[model samples]
Target: MILHLPAQKIPIQEIPIDKKVKLFIKREDLIHPEISGNKYWKLFFNINTYLAGNPEKPYIITFGGAFSNHIAAVSAVGNLAGISTLGMIRGEELKGKWRENPTLVFARRNGMNLQFVNREEYRHKEKLTEFLQSEFPDALIVPEGGTNKEAVEGIKMMLNDETKDFDYLCTAVGTGGTISGISEFCEENQKVIGFKAVMDNSLEETINKLTSKRNFSLIDSSFGGYGKIKDENIRFINDFKMNYGIPLEPIYTGKMMQKVFGMIEEGYFPENSKVLCFHTGGLQGIEGANLLLEKQNRNLII
Candidate 1:
């Protein structure tokens, strides 16, 4: 199952902000309908490398939350490649209630099997991964957010001659793969800023180990912890979409962008600096996010 990346260059559009720093966004979200953005590139080498070996049974096993974009993307890869997929979903309470979740529903429609596990078990994923690998030797078991060495290698494709023109490259850091790749392959003069979506304290060390150079810095962008969306976040997402004609999901992109804007307002960036942020796509999770927001009687992302 050879998945060919789209031949066209992803567009980088300038965000006309009144701030002194010039802001632009690389539309990685426009890469594909299902496997869009960094997810596509992160899985590029992973799935392709696994398929190159030509295992007798091509199966993919991965882990994620109920609304995890990684799970959705992996399921899409399985669907596209005609391979079987198993999703180790966190929260055993969601076992009988998976139908209520959009991401899980999409994975099911893509022919992916869902396995519900308790939080304790999910917390110790290394043990679970070992067991699963022993059980299914032929399966390609991707990490929680596809943040392995191969994934970093795949993320290198996100940078190019066009991206090199920027003084600072930015992205929403989930499992550190995207930022690590940018830090690894970016030019010496360019700095990389990672807007961390999760408050993982060990993320800096993890990302540092992934890249040889120390050209990246991480800032907390978790408005109210991971996956806990705030009213301000929804408002920012809605307003940004209305103003820019670009959609951003609540978890990663929205938070990252909101923080970036805040930093600009605080004069965190120097005057005349060119900043480019990668739109690491996870738009599929927006449906589930909106469903939760609707239940809470709040404004939905448009």
Candidate 2:
């Protein structure tokens, strides 16, 4: 039951943007087909540290929304490690409709047991986590989005000598763990920028507590809302793929890249500043996103 997968040296490629600022992207998405990008790093120490304890009957339990990348990654880890997994999914209505969702279907195929809880119950995750810990004492219950101290520690692997040359480190912020890691471990002169995918008001404070240094800034990148893909977003994603030959999931990477482009255009970055954005992968959500677009007779992401 070895859970420690070797982390890869993900390539940093230049994004050909006609701006004074040199824009680059870290291809973290290419790390794994299933456990891609930041999710892989976030779960790295969480799973390995738990497995190192050598608990008998190892089981993993985690929480996520229907199309959550975290849920998909955790299920993949469970399958790879030969550990049983339980997913406490938000929106109890999905219980009857889980088969329709590509992410949920993938989790099911990976042998993850799905348990749906209502929105209210999901919002109060602390109580649910407490109960689940009691029920499955041996289970490693990862927090929603796998954000924890261990996750922050794992994200350090994303940064190295190749990354230190950049003046700014950028990434799409979901649970704040990824940016927290960058802020905590980044070079003293480097500034961290987090493109917020979800409009969580408490996110700044949450990130502050996660890191001792205050070297990061958050930008509103939620073009419409979390998981609500607009026509413009779809168009941008298609154009980006066509031009850059890089696939970005609409929920996180797509929105972040869009906002980053806007910032570049608006002269948000200083001249000659080297900005690097982490392409945190969640490409698995594309199928489900395209399905929703097809139903609405909207433009699908390429």
Q: Highest lDDT among the candidates is held by which one?
A: 1
Report clash pairs, candidate 1. none
lDDT, each prediction:
0.93, 0.93
TM-score of 2: 0.98
Report the lDDT of model 2 for residue 263. 89
Alpha carbon lDDT at 94, candidate 2: 96
lDDT of 1 by residue, 13-125 (tens): 98888778999999999998999899988899999999999989989999999999999999999999999999999999999999999999999999999999999999999
Q: Write one digit per residue (lDDT tens) for candidate 2, span 205-249.
A: 999989998999999888867888988899999999999999999
Error of 1 at 278 (Å): 0.4
Candidate 2 collision pairs = none
Off by over 4 Å in 2: 1-8
